[model samples]
Target: MNRYFRLCIFFFFAVITALPSQTSASWQPEITIGLSQGLSGVHLSSTSGVLYVYEDLESKPILELPQGSELNVRILRDQIMANGQEIKGDQLIIQPGADGFIRVNHAPYRGYITLLKRKGLTVVNHVLVEDYLCGVVPKEMPPSWSAEALRAQSVAARTFALKNRKRHASEGFDLCSTSHCQVYEGMSAEMWTTTEAVNRTHGEVLFYKGEVIDALFHTDSGGMTESSENVWGSSVPYLCAVIESQMQTQPWERSVSLDALMQKMEKSGKPLGTLKEIRLSPLSIGKGSGDRSLSGRVRSVLFIGTTGSVVLSGNDLRSIFSLPSTLFDIRFRGGEVIFSGYGSGHGLGLSQWGAKELAEKGKNYKDILLHYYSGVTLEKLY
Candidate 1:
């Protein structure tokens, strides 16, 4: 729309994100990253803390785990079984069923273990019922598809985590398959290839001296890729620009070039194709990021500006969707937004393009990770 409107939306996101979450920070730990395995009852546990599962009420089970999947399990709480049984090492095996659940090897659910959950989620890393997204690939999906992309995702993410272990630089990287990144589910025919994708990527996000220098990826949403610095204020060496044809096929086309968008805007007053109303204020940060993609991609409402470059986030999104507001450590300067966003991510940290670039270059998964996440190294939790 107008430049004033864009500025208003930018300020809105900044203020909203800066505010406190409804739940205290202590209640929710920082960045609970959950790894979704296609199988039921099994999930990757990252970000040492408690776990919570995202499941629907009807299908929700008190205890849920994945079957045939292996994840390191550590007990956070000590419990004496009703039968007076004491567990050992505060650790339990995570056994899942084909139908989906964490099969309790020891009755009375012995203890609690820290597991990885989605971003901006609290309630001690737990299970995701329906949110554990897994579905068949569109019948129209290219025949060349073979779960290769998702496998690459796991490998890249894991590699980044591994190499950056020494410095604990886990900030930029995120768990894939969530709305924030890729959608991974091992069981579904669509996501069956995630394991192989990970094998291909090797979870390595390369970095220089602890700073994630490179990591590129592609999501079904971001019709195009993004520049990491523009989003997270850091340079992701490999993600300079993503080509259009390489864009993933998702309902929402994220890649909008300023030059190309200018043509569309010149004909139509709207800069973006979605044209969703947004609130540009800092007051919208902690309103539960409702109806949002699990990755916190949805905000009340906010506007995108026409400018050289601006970092976008969930809060900023509020301005476009007519949501509330928030204040964060980000700044949005309006120029000619020109519908330039090519991806749906916060556009920070690790990018899909950067990941693919590394993968193509024969960089092992771990080596790729070290290139992006600065000052970190890998350590197998198992």
Candidate 2:
């Protein structure tokens, strides 16, 4: 071959090698989510095809039911009973055939179902990570929000799920299907807009120093976000406090009578006689003081009473009173203790409302993500 032809072949091979590998293109991880626990019985069905039932430890399917068939699974002491038939194993896997989804108690799920016997019958959904996010994004944020905001939520939710994949391992699954993990409503909750966002940012995650960061997020930040050390008591470099470009505060107020406040404190195991006064600095946004975090969220409050006194953290007060957030001002007026606050949820990482505002202002998903999670690189891990 001529020298020019040899050079041409060399360049073509180099180009082929530079392209993404097949493994990367097809990389998809499965996530196991605990749907419900402590159930005496659950009804199972398939959307469009046959359902195959198998033991968790066996490869061969034990039973198969036609499309539109229903099976009632119940716990019989330590064994599982399917449609009154006693199954051999303690765990049973219900898989749908063809392009179908399995329904647990009339709710459609993307992947197969695993029914395990714990304290009671535990139902878990085994779904692909991307498909899981399709359910999560719509539930976490409004599906009608700007495309960029949905995409940002997708990345954050994906990173969080992959990072905390083993969160509920002891419970026989990876994560739970509640807000405590990530509110996953299965295929029924998947929307076109959110699914599109998930597809656009497929396999993308936020990484700090080559490791996936715990992408914690919240509903709204009053004006600024709080650091990990402030909210969770551990300093995470990427989870630092960041002020929103457009500070849109969500104001809220709740009033409890002095007698009611005392009763609440007593119910929480801290008995203060008669409410005296609440001591804390004034509300200062983004300015840390002795009693507040950098975002001005209460660090601790000195609760004085006639008989005894107690110092409670802002989080403590929030739990005690069911307040929206810890960023609040406590004032004693008349016979009541009034709590005036701003924002919802624990102010950490990405602010959902803040993301929506930024997206409306033409900021893309990457820009929104970097704005909240500091010093993180957006990479397509798959």
Best candidate (score: TM-score) = 2
The TM-score obtained by model 1 is 0.34
Q: Using lDDT as the measure, which candidate wins?
A: 2
Candidate 2 contains a number of clashing pairs equal to: 0
Candidate 1, residues 201-301: lDDT per residue as tens digits?
33233434334333333332233333455445566555433323333322231233345544554454445443323343332222324333222233333
- Please list the residue runs of candidate 1 whose C-alpha ends up more than 4 Å from where it truly belongs after superposition: 1-144, 147-151, 163-192, 200-223, 246-315, 318-343, 348-382
Give lDDT per model, in order.
0.33, 0.86
Candidate 2 has an lDDT of 0.86
Error of 1 at 61 (Å): 27
Error of 2 at 348 (Å): 0.7
TM-score of each: 0.34, 0.91
